[model samples]
Target: MGAATAATYFRILTEGPHVHRNLSTPQLVEAALARGEASLAANGALVAYTGSRTGRSPRDKFIVEDEETRTRVDWGKVNQPFPPEKFEALLERVVRHMAERDLYVMDLFAGADPTYRLPVTLVAEYAWHALFVKQLFIRPEMSELASHAAEFTIIAAPEFEAVPERDGTLSSTFILSDFTRKIILIGGTKYAGEMKKSIFGVMNYLLPERDVFPMHCSANIGPEGDTALFFGLSGTGKTTLSADPLRMLIGDDEHGWGPKGVFNFEGGCYAKCVDLSEEKEPQIFHAIRFGSVLENVVINARTGEPDYSDIRHTENTRAAYPIEFIENAVIPGIGGHPKNVLFLAADAFGVLPPIARLTPEQAMYHFLSGYTAKLAGTEAGLGSEPVPEFSTCFASPFLPLAPRVYAEMLGERLRQHGADCWLVNTGWTGGAFGAGRRMSLKHTRAMVHAAIDGRLAQAEFVTEPAFGLSIPTSCPDVPAELLNPRNAWPDKHAYDAQARLLAKKFEANFAKFDALESIRAAGPRVSR
Candidate 1:
């Protein structure tokens, strides 16, 4: 099997536990095989794996396929409607073929070993292609790609080729740039490496300059044709907040900004699926009904479908697929100048003001201070407490451009189109999330509704003490009880203490950018 096969197994591993839950053994098997075939077809088997043999690896272990013919271009995956009930039919065929031929499948990460009655190795084996494509779209760099490899090998231009699987050797992509490539073996997360390679192969020599800059943001286009950009690090509710009923979601993560406007680099959205509650965020919950790709999510034992609100199995919960998976996902996932830009921060320290209309300088300052809480299980301790962390631009690790470049582009776009910018805190209301309490989803939703309806535009405002930000006293139709931080603070002292600490954190986090004050933005953060 090729990297395409790796993708098939990844689907099985992530949504595997759910595939046969509602069905019997025969039906489940059929569904599994059918799902695999559909994935291969939908992900573009006709294009990706079709190149002629180019060369062999230095070890003579693998062969590199044709690069020009390869679909280095983009492809979309409508995962849900594919193969449909034919899963049972395809399952019946694969089982009979494998069993009749006495071919025992080796499952790299088999859960309880499949009942196929054949020898199975429950190891971790997911494809590196998807991540490669994602990397290419978001952060295409040879050195960056190498750092995500299987064995931590250094990356260089094509010097060696990959051998084929039938040669009794492993054939993988080393680096994606110059025709020559080899696969690295990532133990637990096997897919990140190959995915990075395929992505880089696209612009290896094609583009004259890397003008497109990758951003950690969600994008949406309003009915009025204006796009609203939401930039945040993980956990600030970018995915949850941007899935608005009134607008079209361009994409949830990873956008590429160019002269044409902002285009979502990813065909899909990588959402934080941990402990997901549909009732709380009905829009996101409803988006995953079918055809959406589930990644590392835990399913209920009985239903075989995802239990979004449950975070017991994993904290690094995610899903990947074309934006169309969501009912209102934008087709091209690109849009023009945004009328509104939001910088979301999950302020754990809670010292920052609730909301502020930022100046371009302040916007850049907060954009680089991407703050949020880590999911409980993603770090060292599982079923334990979450740790709050901050990353510049909420994307220092994976962004394709310098922070100034992104900020400049954002400023220019907003200035050119006359956009309004806001720094919204989604972290904590009282002291901090773990120390105090998380702001209610209802309240956040209410605030968003108010903003959407223009109810808060003329609301009473006061300059926040710490950041000198404007805070609105009330939003129309929202409860008076939920307007300010004090309402959520049972102990005012704790709230004040946490807020100060959080502000200090931001100041320290932004110390690196003190020298970039002279950088010019695309436009002022606020105003026409």
Candidate 2:
């Protein structure tokens, strides 16, 4: 199917008598309540449940393999190929199923910068899903809405299940993206994150062709106009760290580095709410308000208070709200080229240093490696233990193109802009997860601030023998002992053994990447 076929299908899907177009937040909330789709919490945030699947179903996602994407998309376990004919048939079924229901339509923008902005139309089976996307994506003004035409259309019918045998899907859930048709079809899952991430995958493919480097990271501007980026997977504190009181938040996740600067790909934030508290994360805690949407968060029936601690439904509890909910948020969500870029890893093994400066080659090496622990409850199928994996470019799940495409773009930009890069472990310290405690948010924040403000640049540095990272000897507000991971461990030999193990893992992982000798040599030096 081509763009013309997609346009015709979109017209058929929207022509239903029960279609609701561009509903306001209040209207959406009311509709959700009336349809028994959601209930309002005491704080007025809509509480919704995603049945069966509570997190993203990455295994079921597929991209149509056609002439347009056959040669471009990096087909692999991550970017799985779906037969174009299968997609066309499945899309027809989804459109027909959705046309019969009361659909909620939302037209939104993906990028904050108009130059690179992507107009998106979301056709949702649930009113709450529409509200979720409305808050999550850029809501155009009435003036812009009058002339808004979607470059891409997402048809989401969570209730419609795909027959795996007939549809050629792995399961009942399916997230199929067709570049030729410019349509994303999602069904058999109510996980709203699928909708958010599918578009990110699309942007990851589309932006590189336009000379924009798409990133799975958070961005914020310091008081002096210096911009910093936080690249990490979920539970690594990208949203929490970027929501700093002193800095102006550009965006919490998903951004693009273009010729002008960095621009947010999202209008709002989808922050993890597991164990969320006002004391620990005041900005995110308070941001959940009237217009916000809370997913799978347990609420008190009598008092209607949300228990952020409760995770009976899932550990991936989330809060989605407009960026304006955060104080001192940049309206257009655009910032200058980042002066500092930090790669965060929740090292469950407690082997990596808390903070370390990186050479340009080391930065590229780590960027390609994209090492991070996969914490439980963050995804659909995960146990309590943190699973260590290297998500290429910190966004392998979302990147449709080859890893080198993003890695090369980042290298060129870093060289052109002269941005300093650092590695900050936000995971465990002293010993592995079973033995040690998580790194203090206070200490991590102090170190991050120091790096962002150039305080760490002035500090003396020493090489870490195992990984070859430059460990800062001293940092303001941080204890000197905590600056080095080895010193924090009770057993020196045990720490060395753990560090050596991690170094071996790094060496093994980096061997898979086809990079320059300099970049490869920049990796951890596993000692004999």
Candidate 3:
């Protein structure tokens, strides 16, 4: 293909010896099927398997350690440093590796709002990956695509393995981004999420420069045009809670709060499907259809139906489908300024109230802390125990900037909009995971409704001494006792012990955050 047209869209595709331009979804699906990269499941969804690596390899991700990005990024374990020359060499190798192969390319937009949207060109060695991106990002009209220029480019080559020694990489798998060059390189992994997250990372880096606060959250709108933002790390019910049948979903995972309003950073939802039930998550369960891509999900060989309970492949089973797949999704995926911003946590310790209202300072503190429990098996290291982990901004791994960059933006927006903030625990009750019962979805829904409908605001608030959270004395449909953790626990002393331990953990974690003493003081204090 000619370099002029492809290069204008993405320079990386032109650098590659061969470039394929803008293949239709049907054409790409055919190419994927012919190459045996994907197969049609019994349910008519595309079944793709990423051998060995089913989830994102966060440790393998790196940012170019050059003049342009060296000072810009938070360089350490999470944002590892990769030599610019090494990145150049890797790019050359990646380009050459795909030179002889039939490549697939698609140009799409990232942000849904026109003001902040980024034109992205996705270049993939696997046709299925191209189709996946097409579904996961905003598709441009034919006329727009003709003259579309990509602000960023992604070149994914899963078949190309890096040499750790030669490439100066930790392993054969690498996901490196060079902001100065506006290009991202992926190799040695077939997990489609890597591609999805890399684009979000690019936005996380670029948007803040333009004063946009990019978020790892879900957003939705009520009929009265009121908007709400749900912030949480994975396994925290962001997708499930945001997909309310009574509300219109703006987007499920990534979004940007800019001058205009809250806009979806992605065009689709990549929902975790472990133990997903049709009755529990009806919207997500039904969104799996003909064009959906089922990643690492086990399917019955005979029936062709997905066995969501099967962890043989991975606990990180996922489904990727367009946002429109959800029945009540907001077309164009945009929403007004949020009236409420919720910080969701799955507190396995069960010491936190099922729901609590947050002051502005507490909101900033919690937003910065991004505290949540890490369930075992989510990573390689833990046993079946629940461990507390802090992911700053609910997306520390994907954040290229310092935590304060996002936190400060959030505080400013919340104050500017006069938005109410909340902390809701969708975890265990009475005791820790093993000793306690998981909070019922019915009760959680009722509590959220109360928060949104102004019922919780009118209720009497009693401050939880250990956590310094103002828990409501009663909610509309939720029981009075469930509102307070101490009341819910049979042994108040045991609850006090767990509360103290959790408060200490929060203090220790917040010490790492170099913010003003006032913002730091916004955290919890355990009363003796």
Candidate 4:
């Protein structure tokens, strides 16, 4: 077998078939090794394999592979069709497998440093697959047969430390005393049980002593003390929009809040890659070529490496790489008082104002409504789920604590800093998918343009009934041609039909929140 063939086998076994579940792991490994020598021969200087070792330290790593293991799960496909429960299931399985192997997982991803890795949650089998195969933990000798038969097992768990758990590690067992011992960073949407070798990569070495909370928001440390924070549920373009080539992106996704404002938990961005294109997403497309980590993506039919469109294996298309991958990814994902805090809601109903200048109450109302999508069935006959639906703050799960914890934190941060907030509806303004094209990424970009350009900061604000928020009727940097949904509506009648339908939706959805304090007059302070 040649390099391509070897790569193909490895891709299929680890990323291809089993990732989608077509072949067994052992079979894939054997075939990949069989093709390894040929791959090395064709590539000339290419080493047959490479790997790292696991040490007794809080952050210890060792890898050695020679024609043995040198493949990774596609980096771009990490979070496709992100089912909150499914990811959690995967992590739980990894814990089970760790117990089976007696190999304890430890991590120490914390601090205000930008080089550090963000936290993630991976399922068990996937985690096992990532480590042993992708990271080349298990190696082969001159003889492939013996290498194939290496026994694998699990034995025990260390006693939980009676001492205070600062970052979650046994201080005594740690070979590296100076290090904080923990399994992995738990920031972002990573649930506990999934396979998360990606987490291991960043955590292998981290700057010591800082609390980085797992959050899902874009961050940028502005030139001044001003920091701009952008929040959106997945697929709403948090990473893509927050990342401006001209402006420095502090961090694309997760951040850690501490005494001196908030710092980024990740050194980079973990972006979605399905239907990715340089034309539409030049930054993300270009990032994948260098330091970017592509997950679960199909490769070019000829390259046998990544196929951005091959979401068949999993809809969780993703790319994880440092913000540096973008020429402007800020080194330390930290920022100060936000100049603008944008709450992203991909409104599927298309009834909400295109870009609303929000009052604190409406901000909380939309945040609680958490509206932005209807997930259509990838299957042939499965009925479509409502695209525009409400989720608590649009983040249905993944806060180890509670929604209010984050809300309070957000409010406190904004208040002390004296920042302004906005609600940008990136979803359908004219109609939902089938009825009309979903909101244009262009329009969303324009809204963001007006935002950073300071136009939205001074636009005339109008009060909306259902949300009781303010919508900016005019703003600079934002094209006058695209202020309203009508600008994008091709058919006025169809647009109106969808508009009425969405209006009904708002009425219906708000009814639920009517009694809730966040949106209720009596609930929590909707706005200060």
Best by lDDT: 2
Give the C-alpha miss distance for residue 309 in model 4, angstroms: 2.9
Model 4 scores worst on lDDT over the 10 consecutive residues at 38-47
Scored by lDDT, model 2 comes in at 0.92
- Alpha-carbon lDDT of model 1: 0.48
| Model 1, span 40-134: residue lDDT tens | 22322111111222211222211123343233322121001112122223222332322222111111110011111111121111122222222
Rank by TM-score, descending? 2, 3, 1, 4
Model 1: worst 10 consecutive residues (lDDT sum): 109-118
What's the number of clashes in each of the models? 39, 0, 0, 72
Q: Write the per-residue lDDT of candidate 2 for residues 284-389, one digit (tens) a residue.
A: 9999999999999999978999999999998889999999999889999999999999999999988889999999999999999999876665665978766678
On the 0 to 100 scale, the lDDT of residue 52 in model 1 is: 24
Worst lDDT window (10 residues) for model 2? 373-382
TM-score per candidate: 0.61, 0.97, 0.96, 0.61
lDDT score, candidate 3: 0.89
The TM-score of predicted model 1 comes to: 0.61
Clashes of 4: 72
- Give per-residue CA lDDT, model 3, range 78-106, as digits (tens): 99998888987788788778776878888
Ordered from best to worst lDDT, the candidate numbers read 2, 3, 1, 4
Question: Regarding lDDT, does 2 or 4 come out ahead?
Answer: 2
TM-score winner: 2
For model 4, what is the alpha-carbon lDDT of residue 330? 61
| lDDT (10s digit) by residue, model 4, range 1-528 | 245643443333233222422123333334334534212111111111111111112122111111221221111211112222322333243334333322212121322443433322121232222222222121112353222311111111122111214323233121111111222212111111122232322322221133323445788654554577777877777877877665678777655555566676544466777888888888877776422334455555464445567666556566655455577766555666467778787766555566776656556666656666655774345466455556555544333234554555555555666667777877665556656556677777777777766777777765644435566777654555345655556676665666666655555666643334544441212111
Clashing pairs in 2: none
